[model samples]
Target: MGFDTATTTLLRAILDEVCESISRHETGVRAHVASKILEAATKGEKTPDGLKQIGRAALSEAPTMWR
Candidate 1:
């Protein structure tokens, strides 16, 4: 399912915030964070704070090798 512009923008912002400490080269970690946020959104988590929390959790759960 596709998201509207606003939702997309919000998700992107949250991804950036959550991945800020992560290197851009760490595609695995970034993809992991993005997928988790998208998963949460698909499950009806549209709020910024909620999505951010999910993103943060995903980041923390990312492969240790990537971190």
Candidate 2:
């Protein structure tokens, strides 16, 4: 499903905030976080706080090359 401009912006902002501590080169981690956030959003979670929570949890559980 396609999101509206505002929702897309909100999701992007949440992704950036969640991945702030990670390197920009870490696409796997970023993708993981994005997927989680998108999943939540598609499931009717449009709230920033809720999406942030899900994004953070995804970040923590993200796969790392070193792991």
Candidate 3:
């Protein structure tokens, strides 16, 4: 399912914030975070705060090459 422009914008903003919070520069890491955020968004997580929480939790759980 496709998201509206506002939802897309919000998701992008949330993704950016997550990446920044995690200091994720590697493409793989960024993509993983983005996917997590998108998954949350698709699951009806529209609020930025909620999305951020989900994204952060996912990031914390995700296995990383560098810790």
Predicted model with the maximum TM-score: 1
| Winner by lDDT | 1
When 1 and 2 are scored with lDDT, the better candidate is 1
Q: Cα lDDT of all candidates, in order?
A: 0.93, 0.92, 0.79
Which pairs in model 3 have colliding backbones? none
Per-residue accuracy of model 1 over 1-67 as CA lDDT, tens digit each: 9999998999999999999998999999999999999999999999999988999999999999876
Error of 1 at 21 (Å): 0.5
Q: Is candidate 1 or candidate 2 better by TM-score?
A: 1
- What would the per-residue lDDT of candidate 3 be over residues 1-66, giving only the tens digit for each residue? 899999899888887887785665576777777888888788887888999998887678767683
* Per-residue error (Å), model 2, residue 16: 0.2
True lDDT of residue 66, candidate 3: 36
The lowest-lDDT stretch of 10 consecutive residues in candidate 2 is 58-67
- Per-model TM-score on C-alpha atoms: 0.95, 0.94, 0.80
Ranking by lDDT: 1, 2, 3
In model 2, the clashing pairs are none
Task: Give the per-residue lDDT of model 2 (tens digit) for 1-67.
Answer: 9999999999999999988898888888899899999999999999999999999999888766722
lDDT agreement of model 1 with the native:
0.93
Better of 1 and 3 by lDDT: 1
Backbone clash total for model 2 is: 0
